[model samples]
Target: MRVMKLNEVINITGLSRSSIYAYMAKGVFPKPIQLGPRAVAWVEEEIQGWLQVRLDERS
Candidate 1:
């Protein structure tokens, strides 16, 4: 249930900042929770599940 910041997301997912936002725009990535007027964070479980799906696809 932890929240992940953009840099953490990038490091964990191996995706560029633009790519992550692009995927979100395309509705293919998990959306971040708005924390405030100037901040947002994604659910860690959601990102982990997304990664698991990708890993499953590779198998």
Candidate 2:
């Protein structure tokens, strides 16, 4: 499974931190996996697919 941190996700998704968190809260985004006491990351493939879906929807 591919995984990435918040910063990388933000850069790739072009979504603001607040918007990313908001999407998660609304159950529209991938839930992050905790990698440490305070570190978390999303599954890379899932996020990528999510982005693809967003693009497809837009088109």
Candidate 3:
């Protein structure tokens, strides 16, 4: 259950900042697991699997 920060997610997903947040809001993506007062992270395995799913769909 590895976790990643927002910046790491951004670099990996290649999605814009707003788009990332929007996708989370729309439930199209996983919500962040709150860390401290101003920090958050997402499950790395979940995001990795999500990317794999999208790639599979495109193929």
* Positional deviation of residue 43's Cα in model 2 after best superposition, in angstroms: 0.9
User: What TM-score against the true fold does each predicted structure earn?
Assistant: 0.97, 0.92, 0.90
TM-score pick, better of 2 and 3: 2
lDDT by residue for model 3 over 1-59, one digit each (tens)? 88999899999999988999899889889888989999899999889988999999999
Worst 10 residues of 3 by lDDT: 23-32
Residue 59's lDDT within candidate 1 is 100
lDDT of 3 at 36: 93
Top TM-score hit = 1
Which scores better on lDDT, 1 or 3? 1
What's model 3's lDDT at 53? 90
- Candidate 2 per-residue lDDT, tens place, 1-59, comes to 78899999999999999999999999999999999999999999999999999999998
- Highest-scoring model, lDDT: 1
Is candidate 1 or 2 superior in lDDT?
1
- Give a tens-digit lDDT track for model 1, residues 1-59: 79999999999999999999999999989999999999999999999999999999999
Arranged by lDDT with the best first, the candidates are: 1, 2, 3
TM-score (C-alpha, index-matched) for candidate 2: 0.92
Query: Of the pair 1 and 2, which is ahead by TM-score?
Result: 1
